[model samples]
Each structure stands twice: as structure tokens, then as C-alpha cells.
Target: MVTLRIATFNLENFDEVPPNVRPSLAERVAVMRPQIERLQADVLCLQEVHGQERPGQPRALLALAELLAGTKQAAANVVTTSGPNGEVFDQRNLVLVTSLPVMARAQLLNTLVAAPMYQILTANPPAPQPMPILLERPILHVELDLQGVPLHVIVVHLKSKLPTNIPGQKVDDFTWRSADAVAEGAFISSMKRMSQAVEVRRLVDSILDQDPAGRIVVAGDFNATSDEVPLVAIRGDVEETGNGALAGRVLVPVENTIPEPARYSLFHHGKGQMLDHILVTRNMLAHYRGSEIHNEVLHDESGAFATDVKYPESDHAPVVATFEFA
Candidate 1:
């Protein structure tokens, strides 16, 4: 049997910004290189990667691959999809593999999904206005050959839960920001994430429709916790029949092996939260050996952010899952 390690990490906007403006590429690499080396993942899915806006310009992803040179976990093969152009900030999802051979690669972006009624009509308009549904980040899909075993991988970064309030719009008058403004904003954000999750599930279903026993892995910074609506939608609730047969194919979150208090990936205002996850289909779960959340790498000896003489590595932690193949 062959064991493969797959990991997902959010690089926290790895871009080549002007020096002193933000942490430069060199600074990020300085802190991230060692952490990635420790992961030693055969297949790595990355989010918040800054892609080059120009069509033909040099890509930071390639440069990151170069930085892994001479490391045990060097990504000799890498794949990435471009984001929308002419934006002040451009971010993308990327996949890097050291051994697995990619069989196919595709990306989902700007795809439309059904919008909730509340989003379409503030208070029942003459006609429901069309609301654009765009993915916060393109889902990076890659099919890899792990010693002849086809493994389907989908990398995603769901919409963040930030308040969506427009300027000059009174809190009481805004549809998304009324008496319960905070709750309303959260509902809107969750709706966006739920739409994205639905799309991911559709992609999973597409693969399953072709092969019921397909091995699939979906990993990334979901930005939502395990019990949240978004995750609930992606990892459908389990249902069983009298004969003990699963109702349908449902993804399962890899068990959190890390000790209780330390399982979190990010800390905000002293509250630690597990925003990153690695989930696998039932077929893949049969081969799942174990999983790990590399939260330790995000901190230093002093238990604070890993300061590399300049800046912190990343605000998020990396999650790794190991699976055995016969």
C-alpha cells in the first residue's frame, strides 16, 4: 500500500508588493519555506495566492515553486488559474505536486448560482432585480495519478464573513443591514458561501456520476467552521436506510487528531478558530490513515506569531491528511 500526504494552506495574499508597503515576497518566503518543508506534502492546495494580473507576466506561483528548491517537499510540478483582471488585488487558488502526475485540470469562476429572495428584493420590488453570483475564489480542480489511483482534488476559498454595508445607506433602511444588522450581514455572507459550497458539491456529484467509487479530496480555507451552514451544505448530513446503506455520497471531515485546545488555525481577539479543513469522500475515507493540523508552525518558541526578523508567516494554519492506496 502507498501512503500519500495532501495538505491545504492559505498563504494570506502572497503577492509581490512594493517593499515596506506589505510583507514582500522575500519576507513571506522566509517564514513560509520552512513550514511548507515540514508539511512534506506530496500534493498541496494553496489559497489566497496572488496571481499576476497581466496575461503574460511572470507568475508569483512559479517564483514560490522556485523558493522550494532543495527542500524535501519541493513542488516540481505546479498548476494555477488566473483571476479577473484590472483589479487592485488579484488572488487565486493553486496546486503543487511533488510526485503525483496531473491527469486533468480545470477551474470554476463567474458561474451563476441561485440567489436568495432577500438578496434580490429589498422589500418586494416591481420585479426582482438580478443579483450577480460570482465565486469569491475560483475552485481549482485537479485530477492526479497516485500510483495509478486516480484522485480528484478540489481547492476552494469560500466567501469571508465580513459585514456588507454600503456607504450613505442608513442601517435601518438597508435590507441587509436593518435592526439586526450584524445578523443580517452574517446571513448574506453565509448565503454566498452556501452558493459556493453548492457548486463544489455539484462538481463532486459530477465526478461521482461518472464513477461511484471515485476517490475525491476537497480541502481549503472554507472561512466557516464545521457546524456552520456553508460546511453543512458541502458535507451533507448523513442519512441511512433500514438496510444500513448510505442515502447518498457524502463527504466526511478528516478527524481532528490534534489535542482539543490547539486544533484551531487562527486566533482573533484571543479567540482561536478552526477555519481550515480537509474532507474526503467515502471511497477515499476507506484509505484514510490519519490527519494533522500544523498549527504549531504558525507560532514561535514564545508562542506568538513566527517573527522572522520582520513579519509573521501566515495567519492561517495548514491541514494535512494521509491516505493509503492499495
Candidate 2:
């Protein structure tokens, strides 16, 4: 049997911004590179990776390249989600790097489900008609040849818990003028996040419908905990479906196997949260060995007092899982 390691990390706002403006690329690399090295992953799924633009050239992931400069993944096959123009966005691009042979790849954006339309209840004038709720990012699906086995890997970076903006409700970035507006904004954000989760669940169903025994693995920064709505939507537990026959279609979170004390991948206001995840189909879970959350150096990014803090490393910790294939 051969073992394959897969890892997911959210390099929080990873970019080549000016050093004086934010942490320089080299500074981030100095700290992040070691984390990448520790993962030793055969397949790496990355979120919040910014694309860089150069004169007369399409956008490039310069920052990511620098981070993997001397690592084994430096020469791996890299794939990223792109916009309608076939170019990666300037910020928060989903990336997948793997040494295995790639069979096929696709991106999902309102492909399975149509975009929902809703009227803004908190707009200033409240006179406009309903508008389409567009997804901020696409779900990346890649088919890889892991040795001789066909493996389906879906990478996602779902919407954050931050409230969606209302036309005239915000007093500032972090403050809202009206509590009602804040509630509406948060409702809109939850709608968007749950919609994205529905789309992902539909994609998973499509794969399972075509190949029931598909070796599937979904990994990324879900921005939600295991018990949250987004996860519950994607997991499709048999209990929720009330159909035992659908048990084979369920997806299990690998982090559940890890000790609760060491299960978290991020710290917010002194509370540990498992926002990053690696979920696999039961067929693949049979071969699962163990998992790890490299969060020893994690520091709280949110607190009561506001203070400018610059961390060279990413706020999120990397999560990895290993599986052996016959």
C-alpha cells in the first residue's frame, strides 16, 4: 500500500503587498515555509492566495511560488480557480498543488443551482428591486490519478461569518448604525454562505450518483465549524436524509478523529475554532490513517482591545490527513 497525505491551509490574505503596507512576501515565507514543510503533503489545497499582476503578463501566484520555493511541492502540478475571463482574481484564489497525475478539473459557480434573487430590506431608500446574489468564489473540483485509483478532490473557500454589507447601514467597517440593519446584513451573509454550501452538496451528490464508490475528498477553509449549517449541508448525514440507503453518500470529517483538545486550527478571542477541514467519503475513510492540525503557534487575532498586530505567518493553521491505498 502507498500512503498519500493531503493538507488544507488558508494563508490569510496571502499577497505580495508592500512591506511598509503589510507583511512582505519574504517575511511571510520565512514563517509559512516551515509550516508547509511540516505538512509534507502530497496534495495541498490553499485558500486566500492572492494573484499578482505584471506588465504584459497574466496574473501569477508569485507569493505562493515563493513560499514553496524549496519545498517538494515546488515542482508539483498547480491548478487554480479562474473567473469568466479565464484569469485568476487579484485576491482570495483557491489553489490545488499535487504531485499525482491530474485526470480532469472543473469549477462550479451557479452551474448546478441558479443564483437566488432577494430584495434588500435594509437599503437606504429601499426602493430598488430584488437583485441577484452572486457568489464571491467558485468551488474547484479536480480529478486525480492517485497511483491507479481515481480520486475526486473538491477545494472550497466558503463565505466568512462577517456580515454582508447593506447599502446604507454601516457606520464603519466593523460597526453598524442600526441593529435591524445588522441583523438583515447577517441574514444576507448566511444566505450566501448556505447557498454556496448547497451548491457544493449538489456537486458531491452528482459525483456519487455517477460513481457510488468514488474516492472523494473535500478540503478547504469552510469558515464554519463541524456542527455549523455549512458543514451539515455538505455532510448529508443519513440521519438528516432519513434514508439509510444514502449512507454511502455521506461525508465524514477527519478532524473528528483527532482529540478535541488538539482539534482546532484557529484561535479567535482565546477560543479555538476548527474552521479548516478535510472531509472524505466512507470508501476513502476506510483507508484513513490519521490527521494533524499544526496550530501550536496559533495566536488570537480577535480580542476586546483594538491593537495593530502583524503576524508573518498565517492566522489559520494547516490541517492534514493521511490515507493508504492498495
Candidate 3:
């Protein structure tokens, strides 16, 4: 039997800024590198990693490369989601790093599910036509060979609960002009989030249809808790689906294995929440050894105090899970 450790972390807008920036690359690396090293993961899924670009050069993960420098993962195989132009996005790119051999890799954004068209009820002028609720980021899918063991991993960074900006909706960036605008903007955001969730669920089902016992893991910052709609949609719980035959396809949250008090990965308004997750198929549960959330030093990032302070470390903690596959 061989043991594998998987970890997911949201670096929280990890990128290079000007020299005068509050949190320099060195400062972030000092805090983040140790957190990553602690995981000792064979496979790592990262979200919110921004790409840096220079004139006459393609966008690259320079900040990420610097953070992984001299580390085990620095030399590992890396795969990242790119745009239609076949280039990595300038911001919030999903990245997967692994020491194991990568067998296949792909990305999905509105591929399995078509984006729904909706007319903004709060459009500045009279609305003309509906617009597609496009995804801001794509899901990174990779198939790895753990020696002879096949492992399927999907990394995603779903849309945040922050309301999508609608024309004439906001007085400023954070301030809304009225409650109606806030509600409508939030509704549109929810639609996009739910659509992405359905697409992920469809991809999970497609894999299971081909191989029921597929060893699969979906990991990242879902931007929602386990009891939320996105999690519910992807988990496909037997109780919710009312089908025992589909139980094998159900994905279980690894964070659930941790104690209630220690299960959270992020703190908001002083309350702990599990936004980051490592979900595994039920068949992999037998090999599941344990799980951990390195949140002992996590801080709340909800109020003015959080905004005033430049926390070197990411607000979200790194979550790791272990499995022994024979």
C-alpha cells in the first residue's frame, strides 16, 4: 500500500505588487511557505493564484514559483487553467501541483452546462436583451497516476457571495444605492454560483458513469459551507437524492472527520467556517486515514479592523487529507 497526502489552499490574491505594497512577495512567502511545507502533500490544489505578465512575455505564475522555490513542489508537475486564448488568466487562476505523474489534464467552464441568459431587472436604462451569466473562473481537472493507482482530481474556486455589480446598482464599490439593487445583484451572483455547481456535479457524474469505483477528489475554496447549495449539489447525499444506487458516486467531505471546533478553514466576524474542502468519493473512504485544518493562527477578515491590518498570511487555512491506497 502507498500513502498519499492531498492539500488545498487559497493563497488569497497571491501575486506580485509594486515595491511599496504592504505585503510584499517576501512577506507573503515567509508566512505562506511554512504553511505549505507543513502539509507535506503529494498533490496540492491552489486557488486565487494570480498570473504576472511582462511586456512581450506570456502571463506566468512568477509569485507562485517564488513561493515554491527550494520546496519539494517547486520541481513537481504543474497544471493550471487557461482562457480561450490558451493563456493563463491575469488573476484568480486554479493551479494543481503534484509529484506523481500526470496522466491527463483538462479544464471546464460552461462546457457541461450552458450559461443561462437573464435580463437585469435593475439595468441602468431600459433593458434591451438578456446576457449570459458567465463564469469568472474555470475548474481545473487532472488525472494522476500514483504508481499504478489512478486518481482523478478537480480543483475549483467558485464565485464569492459578494454581489455581482449591476449597472446603476451601486453608489460605490462597497456601498449599494438601495436594497432592491443589492437583492438583484446578489440573485445574479447566486445564479452563476449555482450554475457552476451544477456543471461540476455533471462532470462528477460523467466520470462515475464511466467507472463507478473511480478514486476521485474535488478540492478547493468552494466559497460556501458544506450545508450550502453548492456543496449539496456536488455531494449528492443519499438522503437528498433518495437513491442508494448512487451512493458510490457521492463525495464525502474530509473536513467532517475533524472535530466540530477545529473543522473550520476560515474565520469571518470571529466565527469559524469551512470554506476550503477536500471531498473524496465514498470508495476512497476506506483508505482515508485522517484530515487536518491548519487554522490555529487564522484570523477573522470581516470588519474594519481586518481591512486596516495587512495580515501577511492568507485568511483561509490550508486543509490536508491522507489516504492509504493499496
lDDT comparing candidate 1 with the true structure: 0.71
* CA displacement after TM-score superposition, residue 289 of candidate 2 (Å): 0.3
Pairs that clash in candidate 2: none
Against the reference, the lDDT scores of all candidates come to 0.71, 0.90, 0.90
Any idea what lDDT model 3 has? Answer: 0.90
Residue 46 displacement in candidate 3 (angstroms): 0.1
lDDT of 3 by residue, 1-326 (tens): 88899999999999998897777889889988989889998999999999999899888899999999888899999899987787788999999999999999989999999999999888787578998999877888999997776799999988899889988767778898778878888898898889889988999999988887788999999999999999999999998999998889889999888999898999887889999999999888998999999999888888566751378889999999999877
Candidate 2 scores a C-alpha RMSD against the true structure in Å of: 1.4
TM-score winner between candidates 1 and 2: 2
Off by over 4 Å in 1: 53-63, 72-75, 83-89, 96-98, 110-130, 165-184, 239-244, 297-310
| TM-score of each predicted structure versus truth | 0.81, 0.97, 0.97
Model 1 CA lDDT for position 80? 71
Backbone N/Cα/C clashes per model: 0, 0, 0
